[model samples]
Target: MKTMFKKHGPPPTAVEDATFRIRFAELSAGYAGHPVLHQLSAGIAAFTSTALVGPNGSGKSTLLGVLAGVIQPTAGKLHHAGGRPPAFVPQRGAVGDALPLTVRQTVEMGCWGARGLWRRLTRQDRAAVDSALERLGIADLATRQLGELSGGQRQRALIAQGLAQESDLLLLDEPTTGLDPEARERIAMLLTELVADGVTVVHATHDLDAARSADVCLLLREGRLVGQGHPRQVLTPSTFARIWQPA
Candidate 1:
């Protein structure tokens, strides 16, 4: 897979004066005794949606963690086109047992990246929070406690927090997990709107149908990329059976 992607050369460094770009040249990470990925490489252009699809323990979440700078890679280069760091949205379950906080307060926490230790939010910051809430369709729930919202609404709040960061790249781990079909579609549509606004997104999911909505689909297995490119191109019946069907 590395050789195949290399054949096409790297994507452009400067893409349309866009917000940011990501280029991964030979990135690998795993436990101390064993490696999960080997010489993996790819280039993601600005404002494009890339979906990482594979079976369990395929390193999708690990890859996103590395991109978000939460986990350091064991080897290889993961470059951030611009100096601006990417925002990460973990699954809703990851938020368990946190201190009590309001939805607005949680969204305001997103501004922490833009604030100093002693700096407080100004009028502009408050306005940004309100705008983010509105964008995620959670304005009416702003004053509600984060613990009180339903699963879908909570997901929206988390996504809104990421958006409030004003980052060019957004890394999401199973953003639509546990949602009904309607909730899933709504989240997908929200992602499409984000792309239209020039925000690059890299999401990891197990659903092939959801993966197809992305511009690029990467089929990963046992920490290796088996296929890459358009969903229809990479997700053939043979590939599907090989990954999902039992031996």
Candidate 2:
């Protein structure tokens, strides 16, 4: 549940090369018997930032769950480049502050995947946690209680947890949902840097500006792919109006 995807099964009929870090063909998933993603076919290019843009309830979070291997796809073929579990950073609010976990302790949990929950962390694991905190500029806040931090700081800590996982793929859900402009910009910049470092990133966001900055955009409507490509090409004014206009 902490990491990964249903990547088994014969390849789908759709032709795809190694160019994409993730490939899902006719993928469908949801809670109980209800489907949120309807045979959605898409490819996420390696080492690039992909923005999942669509109106609410367009299966964004469900899709992330599929990619993270937390949700089993009800149907379709899904694959990841390395078959390794991706580090998934759920929305900050999704993580309850009542746990009373310290920042460093929370981040160290990312290592739980490599080592079981009750196992003691090795020196390397501790180093990875420390490095993740430093990378997110939260080294000084490592000992702070998660509930005591500001919105932006808390978000950084959550992201640091993902970073500590050391996965080639990273998935995030609305990382900038309620942040101020400056905080959003900082997280956005960090995402760009992660891509440069060769971690394929896919995030669902309502921030149209953030979508525009992505290397690729996947537009969804009614649980289906509507368009995809460079943000400028796929997120044109007309497209936005059509997708976001009042129902």
Candidate 3:
């Protein structure tokens, strides 16, 4: 079978279009009857990198889960302009580290959504997994058990899994957390490359630097939208103080 992983060249220069890939209007969601995201409203641009920034318990993860369709909103509406399901990579802590799986095997799970369980992988599916491993620089560790790798290596493998899914929209939650600077940079660069290839990326993070690197930034506090705009505009010192300052 022909490979589904078509190599798109570098990301195209961004146009000044206001086209949005997803829109959340007055969205509210939570777990166990406790509201986490309150009346949140934002638009994620198509083929752009967006950083969801906020303090702990501010509903960043909840919002990301909603975007990825893993969680349903209790109220309000979410419209996907692209109408395609997104590939979601939750935090490393959320993943099962003790699973007896190799790096390649873990990455291959990304293809499950397309191929389904109990079905053998096609040549295209295998190709996509190989491509993702190479793209994430984890080919050398393909046979390595996920439990044996360092935090950074494990994170890369998870990211490769997300890539293998071949989804146009990728949602990640704190992918760079606990990684060293080099690993963080590698992940960031890969995300930029993905954006260049026309993949819309929305990652929830506490790293201010990572947030600043994105084309758009959405600030949240106490499950509410504090601001949304360019990084420089939305991440002002005052904004930081309001979110991180001890009450």
Candidate 4:
């Protein structure tokens, strides 16, 4: 299984000229008979930062899951600018694998998802991994074991792992959950840099500040789009009140 994704890994296809961005038309996703995302249609422009916002159980994470290809949409088309697979960073605690590995080793594992086993990482691969660590300002922490890192440091390491993959599209879920305000700011700054480098980022978060920082904000409610556009337009106080009415 591992060897197949390495030597015979999917070919690197160029971005299409005609794609305005990634488009999902009439998309619906859910399990069994309950739909988590219903008739969703959104266009995520290439290299832009789009944020998903909603109250609890509003399907924000479910939307990100669909974008990351972790969950298949029950209906509609999802078109991308390129054929490249996306890098996914689910909520902080989604992955809890105990590997007894250092931060650097863990970050390098990003390549393994696509690079597979048997084939050694190339010089370019190593450089990408190093650059990702440097970008996250965790170069010094590289040799430290994952078990020894703080929550913020571990989160940064996971993001660095995503950066190492160098996927054009990145999907993150609640990226700054357990971090302090300072760390949160740092992560936001790093995300800005990633956007500048032409990476399209779509993430889910309940953080109001993070929502404000996004180029586009999508508000979800009961598997429906409450609003889709700028933060000011979508995150009005009234909208919040409606989404999370008092029980």
What range of 10 consecutive residues in model 2 has the weakest lDDT sum? 1-10
Q: Write down the worst ten-residue block by lDDT for model 1.
A: 1-10
Q: What C-alpha lDDT, on a 0 to 100 scale, does residue 109 get in candidate 3?
A: 94
Q: Show the colliding residue pairs in model 3.
A: 11-196
Computed on alpha carbons, the lDDT of every model, listed in order, comes to: 0.82, 0.88, 0.88, 0.81
Give lDDT tens digits, candidate 4, residues 1-247.
Answer: 0001112223223453244457666677898888898877777877888898888888999888887877877776666667457888877687674769899988898898777976789898899999999989999999998878888898899999999898988889999988899989998988888899888988899898988999898888888887888887878888889877853
Model 3 weakest lDDT span, ten residues long: 1-10
Over 4 Å off, model 3: 1-18
Worst 10 residues of 4 by lDDT: 1-10
| Candidate 2, 1-247: lDDT as tens digits | 1222445455633345468788887788889988899888888988999999999988888898899888888878777766458999999889999998999999998999999999999999999999999999999998999999999999999999999999989999999999999889999999999999989999998789999999999998878888899998989989988888876
State the lDDT of candidate 3 residue by residue for 1-247, as single tens digits.
Answer: 0111122233212241238787776788999999999888778999999999999998999999999888888877676765457889999998887899999999999999878988999999899999999999999999999999999999999999999998899999999999999999999999999999999999999998899989999998899998999999989988998888875
lDDT for each residue of candidate 1 in 2-91, tens digit (9 for 90 to 100) = 111322335434552243377676778877767888767776768889999998888888888877888777777666777467888998
Question: TM-score: which candidate is best?
Answer: 2
Q: Using Cα atoms with residue i matched to residue i, what is each candidate's TM-score against the true structure?
A: 0.88, 0.93, 0.91, 0.89
Q: Which candidate, 2 or 4, has the higher lDDT? A: 2
